[model samples]
Target: MSAPTITFNGTIPQQYDDYLGPFLFEPYALDLADRIDYAPVTNVLELACGTGRLTNLLLERLPSSAQLTATDLNPDMMAVARKRTLAPNVTWAVVDISAIPYEDNQFDLIASQFGFMFVPDKLKALTEIHRVLAPGGKLIFNTWGAIQDNTAWAIVNKVLHAFLGGNPVPQHLGPFSMADAQVVLQALTEAGFHHVNATSVKKTGLAETAAIAAQGFIQGLPFATAIQEKDPSLLPKIQAAVEQEFSAQLGNHPLRTPLHALVFEASK
Candidate 1:
């Protein structure tokens, strides 16, 4: 049997969004927008626009003369994102990067934040991104750098696993790590990007050891369901264990997890 498809609104409880809200969109937008300073941008494309965090930043940096198109595979996510009053500079669409629906050479700049790792066929997605970029266009994007560096996830996953009696964690949920960076870069290179490099953008996790980090991943992602497959009633246990461990680790605030953002910028 297949798993039930998830929606952005239904993925996580509102409580989790409140918990994860501080880290959600603002920082990602600022950084991705900052990376494109090397060239003047006229038209832009953004992929996997989860709740419009990066989209917010892109609009701020884009000149009033420019236009931005933000796309995501999940319409529900896009629907939630559409709420922002984004300076009349953004066009929102539901699109799958694996088969990008755009004419060739349409964008001067294209990017995403925390989006690349989610693609089902990464090579196909890269090819499509490349296809849509105009000559001399740039690709600036990022993914989770390493699991150990992200204390919020590391602690959450660890405690949840212990509650589940030490079951192995699935690879997809913790997809980006140091070991995977080389292959990720290679895939981008194979997809025809030149001058590829991954940069370190680290943030200290503010949530403490005991506080439930937020609703974002604990409730928002399909990962918890994956864990549930091992045990029919793991969801409640996972939630409880994560809450207890986080509370044990954090007393009244968010933990200070050192997170890294592995960034790559290159040209076609």
Candidate 2:
């Protein structure tokens, strides 16, 4: 007999939020903040604010009276974000980056964390972001750099891919399509953002064990949602297989995942 499994699983686990925030959020704060000349800043906006990690950071960095707006396309995630939110000064909005509701030049600084890639139309979203920024205002965003150098996620993905036979894919997204430098630059340039730059940064973190790391990836972004329609009975096999692979190599010990990220900062 074998363990029952799911081919298309959509269940988000309990520890996901905790793991995601530290692994991704806290480290990217400084990168996001440096884009703007905060000297005269009065208003700020963030798109794709996952669980308010970066949103809260911007709030903390803002002047006493500075106003900040944070938005997310996922209401569920945003709701979770609101609970852990430390900044009362932030006005969280449920928004689509491609079609921002605010007036043009309404913001002094526009920022995001890992949100630029999911947008359906990069150029439309960029123009909208610029439209809402005052002249000389800036846009700061981040994306996953590349797979080989993304240590933590790489291990997780390798396990899942190996589990699901091989080359597990969702729709047409190849592993690196969204994060490729050329695509990012093109989108920014066409969106009217100048001084475009993309650079890889070092990212590192510790997960207590291989299983925890695997679970985190299983429950996290893009991957879980992307595979939700593949089938309804193969998920457990995938999970089990990955966990076995991880345990065999790295057991229940602390795992440090060194990551690589691409930061893009530009002006409107």
Candidate 3:
């Protein structure tokens, strides 16, 4: 499947950081950060570091001597990230994972959260990630599991597809495209990574209310742009449908739903 072109410019980045961060990303950020063996990692590289949710946690965990290079494909996203995470040891850059702008064998740790699935050339990105890691360095990242496994998003996807009259929705599917653990492991091995491991992790995704959750699902992602392009007038209806569905399946008043993801760890 072709990768969806999702623009992170304009107010989308802010909405993403404000609304989606706590609801969907923060829990996984904590999980990714805790999996790191930070003692030996003096130089770190974070790929697709959107809004610095994990960056902030990495800064807190890493030793003061370590430096973090947090990067994303979108500068607008990095702009929000820079404002959210501040540390002399952390440097922000606009970097495409397919073509990482860094020297080989430079970093002791390379990490990403919910970002790898969006890469169009998974092999090239994995190869680059392996090439840039120091010998014995670790690579850790996570991707959302199947859409059906992530209840809230599954509901949102169903609503979106129905609104679009059962048309193929590539934008919403990109994030969960690499859900299979074996597929990710095979790519990592082909990229020259060893001791590769994949784990299934499930966490609770939270939102203050179903309406707020629906708003984030509709407006806080690139899917919002797709909706706007398809029919700007349908946006409100779509949001309301998602909200109603969320309340029926998962209640409001601090809405919580199970989020499933696959975590991969490998050695270079």
Candidate 4:
């Protein structure tokens, strides 16, 4: 199917934390953390802080004095994040990125990992970030590259497409939605960001076995939600088909596949 309305609920939060987090998100989370100079950042905000993979890294990397507010639109995801990440310096909130409730110039840095793709109005969301960021503050976010560059995702998409008889359901195709660098840069620049830089990052996602990779793709992310919406009865068949294809192509032992992302950073 195309994609599901991006959601993390019920078992999804746990599954996402267990499989997807390590497979695709942790590397970019660490990359985003390394881009920041935490010594000077006293206040930080993390948008779309799903299950807090990046939040934990930020807590570890930032200065002890720094305070962070982690927010996500999904309460279930935030609940999982709060349970996983415990710190006196952090406050959790359920927030809409386009309409931030904070005061002007409230944050020294705003970091979003694989979240901007879900924003319907990218410019409006960036403007909100720019509004709440202090002068010289930074915004660092990453979006996935085109499907062709992401091996596991591409394989899943192909398999799902074929299984669904070449008619994928209509839903939010999150990562593939924001693949244009020029458009992203323009949105940031228009939102009053300066010194904008876009870099391409490539990482190998490690899976102990192709079955694990297939499980992560089939049951751990929004694609699972899509499968349920389209036809709940097809889940087992889909999972088995994807697992077989992955095992045949990627091998069963220690599957490592390429994933690409476009990391964007700018200062206000």
Number of the top-ranking candidate, with lDDT as the measure: 3
Q: How does each model score on TM-score? A: 0.84, 0.84, 0.96, 0.95
Report the lDDT of model 4 for residue 219: 85
Give, for candidate 2, the lowest lDDT window spanning 10 residues: 1-10
Candidates in descending TM-score order? 3, 4, 1, 2
lDDT of model 3, residue 141: 94
lDDT tens digits by residue: candidate 2, 1-268: 1212212122342344665566555677666665556678888898988777777767767797888888887776777678876666788888988899999889888888877765656678888888898888877888777877775556667766654544454312343446688888888898788888887778676667766666666665545543444664665566566566656654557766667778888887
Kindly list the per-residue Cα lDDT of model 3 for residues 1-268, writing each as its tens digit.
2334766777788888888899999999999999888898899999999888999999999999999999999898899889876589998888989898899999999999988877778899999999999999999999988878899988987887788754234643378888888988999999999999999999989899998888887788887777777778998998899999999999989898999999999998
Tell me the TM-score of model 3. 0.96
Model 3: how far residue 183 lies from native, Å: 0.6
In model 4, what is the error at residue 28, expressed in angstroms? 1.3
Q: Write the per-residue lDDT of candidate 4 for residues 1-268, one digit (tens) a residue.
A: 3444567787888888887788899999999888888879999999999999999999999888899999999999888898876688999999999999999999999999988888878789999999999999989999998888997888888888777765253424366777889888998999999999999999998888888778877888766777788889988888898888877777778888889999999999
Query: Clash totals for all models, in order?
Result: 18, 8, 0, 0
| Location of the lowest summed lDDT over 10 successive residues in candidate 1 | 1-10
lDDT tens string, model 1, 42-95?
989999887777787777777888989999887767766777654777898988
Model 4 alpha-carbon drift over 4 Å, by segment: 1-4, 165-173
* Cα deviation of 89, candidate 1, in Å: 2.3
How much is the lDDT of residue 217 in candidate 3?
Answer: 76
lDDT of each: 0.69, 0.69, 0.87, 0.86
